[model samples]
Target: MGFESVPSLPLEGLETVDAARRPVPASPGTTTTPGAADRAALRTDSARANGAATASPAPPDLKVVPLPVRRAEPGRDTPAAGRSSIIVLLQQVQEQHGYLPRPEVVRCAGEAGISVAQAYGVASFYNFFKLTPPGQHTIRICQGTACHVQGAQGLLERVQSELGIQPGETTPDGLFSLETVACLGACSMSPAVVIDGEVFGRVTSRQVPRILARYRRRK
Candidate 1:
């Protein structure tokens, strides 16, 4: 039987048709090259995937700086410089009060920015600073080396007996206060006694009553 023959397709055309029908599998080591738009889309997807990791802001810089150290300078305004001023204030208080009164000393300490104990220490350390009030008249007996050798003890005893008071004591009448000093600067006249700023040289124990009588008469 004689039949009509159809045209046979080319091998390349068949390969093209097969490729359109089903995708060709890539070789093991081969990679597909991407176009510009495809590459850009891929980059956008990658950025979106890693957005959480790269979206945070950078941390701030922290630097530690040390403060400057201050040193005290010597001047009239400083604490050490105020020492002389405090002493002067104490002296003024003594001059007005005749002695270092406890209240006045406390006030002075406040003004000087010092402790009460410190103020009292200064008051007690010096021989001139008297803590008690003075009597109407003050009597000082010298007990220096020269005076002691010249029977100053006997004279002091006589005065105490006559006044009915011991050294650093005030008479019952408050007319006189007795005090013994290391020296009266009258060494040339040993056994010197000073009553109300009057210095009597080489005094004897017998002369005690007469010397005391003069002050009594004045009172």
Candidate 2:
């Protein structure tokens, strides 16, 4: 006998599962999808890793080094300090040679580390520093105010004529060297003439020949 089939169950009362909505098992080296905060954190971490791998090594510690200082040697002076010594050296050379000879002056300038012109300038400026050799006797005629008022010009002319030389020249016989001085400190005896260190004051034009004859007769 055929029996009537029971009615099919209602699909509305049963639950259904979708394959796409189900949780999946993760494979090796696979991760789940990250949220916004997690994605930001992962990017920061990746950037830091890359920067660390490509960065240069740190430099060594810096040190300050001082340079060496130089000290001057003993008894050695600078060029500026040595200028004053030049005068002293020149005086000594003049004392040794009696006059500043050209060769001696050059030698002195070399010793003093100065120029030849400088030494010559010093030599020529001072009246005491004679350039030419002096004769056996030196005659200094005074031309001070007292002597000038007392007819010293006449006495000078007489001396010049008798010696056959100027005021700054030596005689051909090498006996007398003539020079003119500003003062002889003998104002009381004006018109003074000094011959070989002897002061002859109140000298007239006639007395010049007699005074020079005394020195000429001397050995």
Q: Give the winner by TM-score.
A: 2
Model 1 over residues 1-219: C-alpha lDDT tens digits?
Answer: 012233332111011122222454677966544564366566667766887454332232344344342322233134543343456678998889878889998877777666678778767766566677877889999998999999999999999889898876788788999989888999999899999999999999999889998999999
Minimal lDDT window, size 10, model 1: 9-18
Candidate 2 similarity to native, TM-score: 0.59
Query: Candidate 1: TM-score?
Result: 0.56
Each model's TM-score, in the order given? 0.56, 0.59
The regions of model 2 sitting more than 4 angstroms off are 1-84
lDDT of each: 0.73, 0.71
Alpha carbon deviation, residue 125, candidate 1 (Å) = 2.6
Residue 22 CA error for candidate 2 (Å)? 86
Q: Distance from true position, residue 134, model 2, in Å?
A: 1.1
* Per-residue error (Å), model 2, residue 33: 68
Question: Mind giving the per-residue lDDT tens digits that candidate 2 earns over 49-163?
Answer: 8885543322323443443422222245344333444556668877887777899888766665667786687677666677888889999988888999999989999999999
Candidate 2: residue 100 Cα off by (Å)? 1.6
